[model samples]
Target: ALNKRDRIDPLEKQDSWKDFIYNPRTGEFLGRTAGSWASFSLTHPEYFLRLWVGLGLVASHCQNYNAGRTFCQSRMVSQNTGSLKRYIQASFCLSSSSGYNDSIQERNDLCMVGEYTTQDNEPIKKVCQFKRSTLRQCSGLPDPSFGFKEGKPCIIIKLNRVIGLKPEGDPYINCTAKRATSLQMQYFPSEGRLDKMFFPYYGKKSHPDYVQPLVAVKLLFTKEDYNIEQTVECKVEGSNLRNDDERDKFLGRVTFRVKVSE
Candidate 1:
């Protein structure tokens, strides 16, 4: 889009950007693309929405999987899918690429776990916000595991600062991230299954039929490494754990508390 706006520029051109909106036109170096402003200009609202959504799905996966490299490379989006089959498979743990990880997401002698709701009589709300923290002091950074289920969620509070905190009831799954490649198949994990997983995505809800409009955080994969950037894409259509309502929120996107890997 804006980050790489020339996808449909007047003159045929291409750029390297995964985040931004771009204008569309007829006939480009890539090919004729359905422009958001051109094709959906007069179509029904749903039609326009559908077009944008389809493209969005492709973009998110492209950026996340290839470190923001897809259409820009192949220039041929034969189809849009989430299956690990259609794309280049990742065979190694993302940690192998640690040459790029330096942010809070990659902790030093830290456990890759999230906080659970600190309250007993409540499920974490979509609006509760707080500071960063560590759940336990493990001797070394153990491989992480994660899960999302219908349970109490944890609040993000600054380390040792129970200032506005009063209770601890949320249930959280400790986690570590892996490259989308390692997750060859969707294996349901328990309390701490993804400890060594390459791409660990655990929320309070793991069921594919779950609907989360506003949860706590969104966890996403980045190419630069060690970065936890705030994103607006929350859900993807036909996502394993997504419904139509939650599509526009975190499509191809997940939220988590990264300690600023860099």
Candidate 2:
């Protein structure tokens, strides 16, 4: 047989085989031989400690991935909910009719005492009347007693801004004479009472040609002994109003202080 040293493979001692344990180009450490491990621990103990600490940190972070994922999902949900609420609130609002401010609440003044005459220059002594049912269809007849006409005393209520999403039906106006029940107030749309087709207002910027809906209020003094100075509350009811304290707070009202002078 050959000698033991001569039987050893010469390839095992080559540089390529020695470099296989640690690749400098790829910065990867393959499994070291027993002798190589022992040599590295003794000569570069700090590097070995750093590698062990890095492995421990990586293992701990991997375990927290589920917790981090849950937190991210919850934060995203909260952000989405907040955005939706803001969008809903901004989509609808009630505004003043005078173009003075964008608010539902307002105050107006009217002259109760006037020599309201007809086109024939005839003074109106009795209360002028226009039935709510017939106002839309009835064109202004020559008879001032029947329809809305020029020289007739009337209160003009114009809704300058109405912001809302697409509503189901057209919004109508419901007016009540508060405190001054003797005062007769009628809804006088140039056509009739406010029609439902006017609403679900897109924004002013979106509909530049949008015209504000106007409601003409014709006030008539039914009683001769009415107070000289009276404050009348007229409420214009809106749709889907919130009820609070047994009252619909979303409804807008205008207080008209009328002063009658002979």
Candidate 3:
């Protein structure tokens, strides 16, 4: 009779199986076997610890997917959160139509239609109006520097478009410092609330002119807070949102570091 060592899993010889567990280019296994794990931990425990920590970081930062469909309807996922900069400015290439500039949120039953060039055969869908001017200081119109010169930096946060997802309890963004020190912030569009009208995203083929809503957070740093790098975490708060996933820190939130240098 053949020993267990001679009866290796035949599936390991398959290309798909190899691709799933090993990187051909890097010559590294995606995950280790029991024997390999034990050997690595016994020999190089620090490397093994760092490997797990690296995996945790990747899981926390990566975007979540639903079923086979992507969470974002369009290319909006790439713009989920803007880069952390000393000063951030928001720019837009919006339609000149008067309706696109409306700052008021329409009734839930109604939607303001946006203008988009579509083929005659495509079905018409209502795309809600997201006023870019609501960002005020971050709009890049009033001050191109976006408050950077004044020591108050503006950061714009926009949620990725999730199809058929409607936030409950009036979702809003709340930003706080990770450290014990206080971090003061002021929000544009009042309370950093993500308006309801911009949700329930239709696909790009249907809602071609759809624009995601934005919240501008202006950090109000005191003289003492300046020159010190502070880690800030911003979360979407609502009855339906989940922001407390220990394994995934960005479930309904984003964390970034910022420092204002005078």
Top TM-score model: 3
RMSD of each: 18.6, 34.5, 14.8
lDDT of 3: 0.55
Cα lDDT of model 2 by residue, 138-244, tens digit: 21122212211211223444443444422223344444445544555565564224444444344445544344444555556433523344454444443432112
Q: Write the per-residue lDDT of candidate 1 for residues 1-262, one digit (tens) a residue.
A: 4567534664333342211233243333234245644544334222222111111121112223442333334322221123332332122122232222335334323323343323233343222221112121110022111111111111111111111221123222222344443211121122312122111212334322111111122123233432332212222222122224454533233233221122
lDDT of each: 0.24, 0.33, 0.55
Worst 10 residues of 3 by lDDT: 49-58
Ranking by lDDT: 3, 2, 1
Which stretches of model 2 miss by more than 4 angstroms? 1-152, 165-170, 190-192, 222-227, 242-251
The count of residue-pair clashes in candidate 2 stands at 1
State each candidate's clash count: 52, 1, 0
Q: Write down the TM-score for model 2.
A: 0.36
